[model samples]
Target: MKTQPATTQIGWLGIVLLLFLAACAAPPNSPTPSPVVPTQAPSPTPSPLPSPTPVARSLRLWVGEDAAALPAIQAVITNFTQASGTPITVIPKPPDALRLSVAGLSLSGEAPPDLIWADQEILAGLLADGYLQPVRASGDALPGLQTAATSQSQLWGIPITAQNQLLLLYNRSRISSPPTSSDDLITSSRAAQGGLVMVWDEPYWLVPWLYGFGGSLTAGADGPPSLNTPAMLAALNLFGELAVAAPAEVKTYRGGQRWFGEGEVGLMVDGEWALSEYRSLTETLDLGIAPLPRIPATNQAALPLISGSFLMFARDLSRDDLKPAEELAHYLEQPTTQIELALALGRLPASMEALADPRLQADPGRAAAANQARQAPGLPPTKAARCALFGIDVWLPSLLKGNLDQAETAEAMQAEAEACVTQ
Candidate 1:
C-alpha cells in the first residue's frame, strides 16, 4: 500500500534474477531429460541364413600287383578327384600275399585294408566269412558297368578281371593247323616230336576236360555227393593217357610258362598272361590262341575256373566312408580302365563294355582271349566242388605229387570233398 521508489523496484528484479541463476545450478544428483531414441525397422527377421555347403572328402584304396595297369589306375584316380573335388590314395600289395595279410588283419580286427584285389577262390572264402560288401552296378559312380556284372542274385565280389585256364597256346610255326576238337588235340599231342606241354599236374589246367566230358565236380540242381559219375571217369582216363604221353619233365614242370617259354613244347594249354613271356622268348615264333576244343561225344562248352576278383573291405566304415570305396571300385570297372588293364595285363575285363572296347577289337590276341572268356563257363560255387576237380590249393599239390594211384587218389579226393559238402 505505501508508494515505493523506482530504485526499490530495480532491487526486487535483481533478487528474481539471482533466484533463477541458483535454480539453473541445481545439484548433479537431480534427474535429467533423456535423449529420444529412433525405433529400428524390426530387423528384417534374418532369413535363417542357409547352412554352409558340405565339403567333399578324400578316399583311401588298396590295390594288388598290376604293375602294368598302374598308369591307367593313377589317371583314373586323378581324373575322378579333379571332377568330384575328392582325393584318393592307393596302396599296392602283392596278390599272393594279400589274402594272408587281409585274413590276419580281420582276425585281429585292426587296420584292415579298404579294398582288396584277391583271387576268386580267396574271395569265396572271405565272402563266406562275411568280410566283404556286395555292390550294385547301377550308380553315378560307375555308370559304365553293365548290370550283369552286378546282378543281385550272385553278388559276392566285383570281377575286375576274368582269367581262365583253358586257353590252348600253340607255336604257330610248328602247328600249321589248330585243332577244333579235343580228339584232334589228343592226336596232335601224340604226333608232336617234342611232345605237347599242357599243364599236366595243374588242376585248373584240367577243368575244360572235366566239363567237356559232362562231369560236374559239384552237384547241380540235382543235389550233393554225386561227382563220381561215368563222365568224370572218362575225363580221368583221358587225363591219364595225356600224362603218360607227356615228357618226363612234365612231372617236374612247375609252371606252364616255363615249359612254353623254353619252346620245348609244340602246343600248350595255359592262361593268356603267358603270351608276353612267350613273345619275349621269340617274337618270330608264331603264337596262336584258341578256346579249349569240344569233347567228341558232348558238344557243351566246358567250364573253366575263374581266377580272381576285386573286393571292397573297410573296417567299421560308415555309409559315407563306403561311398568313396564304391565309387573307386566303379571307376576301375569303367570301360576305359578295364580295356587298358586287359591290354596291359593280358587278363580279361569283367564288363561287357570293356569286352567290346575298340582297342581290344584291334588286337587278335586280346580278341581271342576275350572270346575264349565269353565262351568259357564259370566253376561251381562250392569249395568242395572246386577242391575235388578244379585243382584248388590243397588237392592240387597232392595230385601233382603222384604218390597215389588214379583210383586211390580219386577216392581220397572224392571222400574229402564229400565230407566238406556234408559239413
Candidate 2:
C-alpha cells in the first residue's frame, strides 16, 4: 500500500460526484419532457347502465252510446283505468253521426279516436272506405257478428254485446198488453191514432218488416238489390200505414223512450238496447218488452236483425298503438265487464260465459229479448248490405213524406243500391 497525496484523493472524489450528477441530468439534444400525467388505467371505463322502459300512452275511445247508457259505460271504463294505471277519455256520439264525425276528423282539431263503437252496418261501411284498421281481436262472437268482427282473413273489431233484437216496447200504463199480431197492432193503433211511435227513419227498423214480407235486400250477398219486388211493396205499404198512425213528434229512439215515459205514447218499436233507458225514464210507467208483432197478412213473424256491437280501431291508430286499444277492448270483452254491461244496461253480452251467468239467465227482461233473438233471420253480412241500407235511408224519407210513392221509392232505392255496389 503506497501512501497517496490528499489533493489527488480529493480530485478523484470530485470526479466521482460529477459523474453521478451527470447521470441524473438530461442530455443537451433531448426533447423537453412532458409533465408526468399519472398514467391512468383509463378509469376502467364505466359500464353503461340500461335505459328505462317507456310508459304506455293513454287511450281515447269514441262510443256511439245512448245518453242514458253512458254512465254504465264510464263505470266499466273506470275500472280498466284503475287496473292499468292509464287514463282514457270517452266521447259519446250519435250512432248515425259517427260516420260524419270521422269524416271531419282531421278538421275537428283533435286526434281521431283510438277505438270506435261499431255495429254490423257501420263496420261494413267503414271497412270499405278505409276508415278502419284491422284489429287484434277475435273469438266466440255471436253468429251474426261474423261480418262485423272480421274482413275475410283479418279481425276488425271485438264483439262486446249481441242479440240486437227489435223489441215491441209498450208503456204498460197506457196499453195493458202487447198486441200479438200486425192485424191486432193495426187495429189498436188506428183506434188510438197518434198513440204509437216507431223510429221508422232508421232503415234497420224496416229490415224486420222487409224480411217478414218475404223481401230480401239483395238477391245474393252482393247487390243489385231486390228493392222493387212485390214483397218490398207490401212491406213498404204496411210500414207506411203504421207510420200514419204514429205521432210525428216521437220518431227517434230517444224521443220514443221519452214520450213513452211521459205517457204521451202508448206503444213504440225499438231494440233491446233501449230497455234500461225506458225502465229508468219512468217509475210510474211499467215498461214492457215483447217480440215484434207477427204480420197477419204474411202469416210470418217479423224477422229481427240480430247483431253484435263491437270495439273498432280507427284508421289513424298505428299498429304499434293497437296494443293499448286491444287491451282496452279485451277488458271490455271480459266476462266481468260484459256481465256488468248486461246487468246495468240490458245489453246482451257477446261473451258466452257472461250470457250464461245466473243473473242473465234469470232476468225476465233479457229472457224476452232472447226469445226475439231466436226468431231473427240469419242474414249474412255482405259488401252491398250497407249500400242497400243506404239506399233505403235515402229514399225512405221521401216515401214517408209522400214525395215519392212506394213504386217510385223502391225503384229509386234499387238504383241507389246498384250504383253504390258497382262503385
Candidate 3:
C-alpha cells in the first residue's frame, strides 16, 4: 500500500490537480441554477349564460264581410303570418253592424279585437266613442284620406284602402264609350230602350249630384250641416229633371243592382264595391266603368265623396296584445302589402309608391276613378250629418211618386236634414 508504481501515483496526482484548477477557474458572480417548477394546467373556461327565447303571439282582427275586400285582406294576412311568427284571426261582420257589434263586445268585457277594418264613416263613430288609438307613422298619405281617418288633430287610424266612390257602370254592349257629360248621358239613354238608372234616392248616391252643383252636407269639417242653400236647390232641380227624363227605379240600391244585372238599364250608378259582381256578370253582359258624368252648369265632374278604410287599433288592447297588433298594423301599411291589396281589391292605394305602380296606371277605369277621387271633396265625421244626408230617401220617394210639389219636397227635405243634425 505504501510502495506504488510511478504511473498509478502520477494519475492520482493529476486528478487532484485538475479538481483544484476547476474550482479556482469558476466566476464568483455567476447565478445559481433554480429548482425546476411545473406549470399548472390552464383554468377551464367558464361557460356563457343562455340567451332568452322569443314568445309566440297572436291577434284577432275584425273585418267587414265585404266579399270584394275580404279575400284580399285574407291573402295579405296569410302572407304576413308567413313573414312573422304571429297568427291572425279574421272575424267577419256586417259593415253596417260593426259599430253595434263592437259596442256589444266591448261592453261585455270581451277583448273586442286587435284591429277594426272599418271604413271612415264607421271609424268616425268609433273615434268619437274613444274606441281607437293613434298610430305612429313616418310617411305621408292622400290628403282627403288623411282627413277622413283623423279626429281632433290626431291621426286615429291608418287608411289601408281608399277609392270607394260612386262610379258610373255601363253596359258596354249598348254604349261604346262612357258619356263625358250628363247631357250626353241623357241623349244616349233616349236612344236606348232603357237609359241610365241609379240609386238616386239614397244620399250616399245623391251626394255626388249635390257636389256637382257645388253643394255639400256640411259647410266644412266639424261645421254645422248646411242642408238648405241655393246650391241644394239647383241640385234638387237637376235631380227632378233626371227623374223625369231618365227611367227612375223605385228601390234605390237593390233596384239599381237588380235592374243592371237583368239588363234593364244601359248605365248604372254604383260603387267600386260592385266591380266583382259586375265582372262576374260579364259572362252575359259586357260591363264597363267610368267616373261620374260632368255637370255643365257647375263645370265639375259629379264628385263622389272620397273615403277610405281604416286599420284601427282597438282602444282596449292588453299590454301583451299590443306588440302583435302594432306589428300587424305596420305590416298592413307596408308598400308591398298595400300594393297587393289595392291590386287585388281593385281599390285605390294610399301609398304614393303603390300609386306609381304600372299595373294601376294601365287600368283606365281605376285611373279614372283615382283622378276623380283626387279632386273629390271629403265629408264631415258627424254621424248625424250622414243620417241627415240619407234622409233624402224619405221625402224623395214621395216627390218622385207625385205626392209632394217641388217647394214642399225641398221644405220637407231641409227640415228632416236640419232635425237630424240638430239631434
Candidate 4:
C-alpha cells in the first residue's frame, strides 16, 4: 500500500544522471584503488656532433746529407716536436747545396728552406751575401764557436759541432804506434802494404802540409794568396817528397776513402766526416787514429783547418716565424743536445760545456781531435779562396805529374787567386 503512494514523475535526463553517478562511486567491498600516478613530462635526448681536429704549427728544416749528422739532428727535431706540439719537415739536402740553400740561391727551382745547415766556410759567404739573419742566442755561447758564427760584428747563426783538423788514421796492425814526425811516417809507410794515402793535390788537404811548414794561404784574412812565398815552396817540396813515396791510388778524396776502408792503405789522411765509415771498416781491420805527424824540417805539428756546422735562418722570415726558428736553433746548441751530437758523430763539441763533459774527456779519438784543434787554424771560406781552390784543382795534377815546375805552379796559383779576388 505504501509503495503505491509515490507521487513525482522522474525525467529521462535525471534517470541517466543517477545511473552515471552510481557508476562513478566505488563499491564498499571492492579492494583499495591504486594511488593515482602523477603524469610526468619526458626529458628530451640530444644528438651527438663530431669534434674538430686541431692543426699543428709547422716549420721547414734543410739539413746536410752527412750520414753522421742526420741521426743527431733528427733526434733533436723529434724531441722538440714532442715538447712543443710542433711539426717539422726535414729535407735531406746534398752537402754541396748547403751554401746555395742558405744563401737562397737554389738551382733546382725548389722553394728556399726556412732553416738551413751550413759550415763555417759557407756561413761567411752567406753573411757577406746578406742571406742570413742575426741570431738571438744567449751570450753564453762558446767563444770560438761564437766567433765562427760572427761576421761584421754580428752573430749570424748558432754553431753545432766542429770538425777538428785533418786526422792521421793508420792501420794499427801494420804500424805498431803512431808516427811522431813526417820522417817516421815515411819510414812506416814504405814498409806497409798500401802505404800513405791522401788527396794531396787538393788545397784542403794541402793546407796541413803548408801549415806544418809555417805557410798560409794568405798573409791576412782578406789579403792576396801568398802562393809564391818561401814557406809555400818549402811546403810544396815536402808534399812532393811524400807524393813520391805514396801509392799512385791516393789521388782523389774518394779514392783515399776507398783505399783506407778496404784496408789497402796503411796511413790515411781524413776528416771527422769519415770517422763512422772508418769505424765500420775497422770491424774487419785494425784501425788507429792520431793527430797528423809533425814536419821534421820545421819541427811543427801539422795544423789542418778547423771548421763547424751552423744553423742559419732565412732573411725573409717574419718576426713571428723567426722567433720559433731561433728557439729551435738555440735548443740545438744547448749543452745536452751538443753532447749527444758530439758522442754520436765523434766530433768535437762546439759548446764549451759539452767539451767539459766526462764522456768527451774519456774518448781517445776526441782527445786527439781536441789537441789538433789547439794547433789548427780556421780556413778562410771566402768566394775568392774557393775560386783559388778551383784553380789549384786544375794546376795540381800537372804539378804532381811533374809536367809543371813548382815555381810555375806557384805562379799560376797566385795569378788565379788574384783574378778571383779582383773579379
Candidate 4 lDDT over residue span 188-284, tens digit each: 7777463888887778777788778887777655556667777777777777877766776556678878877777777888887677678887565
Model 2 agreement with the true structure over 1-423: per-residue lDDT tens digits? 998999999999999999999998887896789888776665577889989978767677888877887899889889998998767888898888887787887799767788887566677767777888777654455555554455556777787777667788777777778898987787777665227787787888888899899887877543356788888888889888888667766656777767777778778787776666667776656777777888988888887787877788888887777677777887887887888887887668876556667888687567666655544653444566767888998999998888999899889998998888778
Candidate with best TM-score: 3
Give Cα-based local distance difference scores for all models: 0.62, 0.76, 0.76, 0.74
Candidate 2 global CA lDDT score: 0.76
Candidate 2, poorest ten consecutive residues by summed lDDT? 372-381
Please provide, for model 1 over 40-104, each residue's C-alpha lDDT reduced to its tens digit, 9 standing for 90 to 100: 77765668889998876555566665566667656766887776666777667676666666778
Cα lDDT of candidate 3 equals 0.76
In angstroms, the error of model 3 at 56 is: 5.3
The runs of at least 3 residues in candidate 3 whose Cα sits more than 4 Å from the true structure, single-residue gaps closed, are 1-48, 54-56, 67-71, 81-97, 106-109, 192-194, 248-264, 280-284, 318-327, 361-365, 402-411
On the 0 to 100 scale, the lDDT of residue 183 in model 1 is 74
Q: What TM-score, computed on C-alpha atoms, does each candidate reach?
A: 0.76, 0.65, 0.77, 0.72
> Which pairs, if any, clash in model 3?
none
**Model 3 lDDT at residue 143:** 70
